[model samples]
Target: MAEKEEYVKLIGSWASPFSRRVEMALKLKGVPYDYSDEDYLVTKSPLLLQLNPIYKKVPVFVHKGKVLLESHLILEYIDQTWTRNPILPQDPYGKAMARFWAKFVDEQVTLIGFRSLVKSEEIDVAIKEAQELITYLEKEITGKMFFGGETIGFLDIVVGSMIPFCLVRGWEGMGIDMIPKEKFPELNRWIEKIKEIEIVRECIPNREKNIEHMMKIVGRIKAASKTA
Candidate 1:
């Protein structure tokens, strides 16, 4: 692509699932870029605010000075622009199916499902809700390497970004284990397979470390809320 002539930059955070998605996409597609870490809560830089005023979130990609927000959108842009190692399926239906699962997991699993932990009522609903989703996955996803077919595709990147988060917090911290070893064998198998991939392995956060990090953050926020 003509865009390679210009520098590519990514503003991301260390433990953010969203940032990991973009990082994995860029790595999979063989897109060379620089990464700048941003602190979302403490201090956000001017460049980050300017690039993503609406959300002011991390995982913003700057291509030749043009800013792109949202991890999913950035991943699609990288896949289309690079054309090196294609992430999406070629077949039309296959592509749609892959995208469906990806979006479903990204929106529900990561955003809504994970947030359920902090609140007492939300925690119960979150567990039940996650189990329902996993049940559907167990039935629908039978064989075929990934959610797509053979190679790891777009869906893999998005879901994989959440895998570590799920394992660390949802499973280890909360003691939920939505994908119990016996019940969701296929999903567990896929998680094991994903770990073998270097890019996936490297980008995922350290599970134990993240649990501690998250606890500290959550505790501080809860304490502050009580005082307020």
Candidate 2:
């Protein structure tokens, strides 16, 4: 464990992929910090509101009272500040490409996957889009062990958080296989290797809990659609 820094707190939710991203960074850096888990479905925390007034989302990393909103920004800050187990590459072009793929994961994969899970009307279309996103990622992934060759990097952290909550939970709870093994053999292998990392194992969202939560969201969406 790293020496405790001056009051580091993260206001996030367990089921939130974005929150999980920051958590993965902190854990990987061996930073000791406090986690304030919020219930997004029920109510919002005052600090979450105060920290992220505009976007109003989880993964608001507060380090020494310097509030950081947005998961990607928090991740960059974590890498620069911690100076240990660096997530982003030091070179200019490597860092740029990493950010590009991370944005794709957020805008394409995460949005499409969540829509598939929570909306009954767009389930099939959304699932198809999610599959296409995974196919694209399979080719983009060039490393043997992770996105950045031997060690986990920024792109890995972004996509890594999605596996347990999105991929694994989607398969187990909804029988939705976004990445088919026969087609996405490389991706499947990458996932297995990323899972082997201790920090990844510890940081991924709870599988069973996320499954139950996703099912509830699907049920509610279905019931509402029937009335509409």
lDDT agreement with native, every candidate? 0.76, 0.81
* Alpha-carbon runs more than 4 Å astray in model 2: 1-5, 118-125, 219-228
Residue 209's lDDT in candidate 2: 87
Summing lDDT over every window of 10 consecutive residues in candidate 1, give the lowest-scoring window.
163-172
TM-score of 2: 0.88
Off-target runs (Cα >4 Å) in candidate 1 are: 1-4, 121-125, 166-168, 216-228
lDDT, candidate 1, 34-100, per-residue tens: 9998867578999898989999888889887788898878888888888888898878997788778
Query: Where does candidate 2 clash, by residue pair?
Result: none
Model 1 TM-score on a 0 to 1 scale: 0.87
TM-score of each candidate structure, all chains considered together: 0.87, 0.88
Residue 173 lDDT, candidate 1, scale 0-100: 69
Q: Which residue pairs collide, candidate 1? A: none
Per-residue lDDT of model 2, residues 1-228, tens digit only:
233446789988888778888988999888888998998777888888888889887888888778888889999999999898888988999899999998988887776776777655666787787788778888987446788767898889888887545556855687777677898898888888888888888877777888887777667766887899
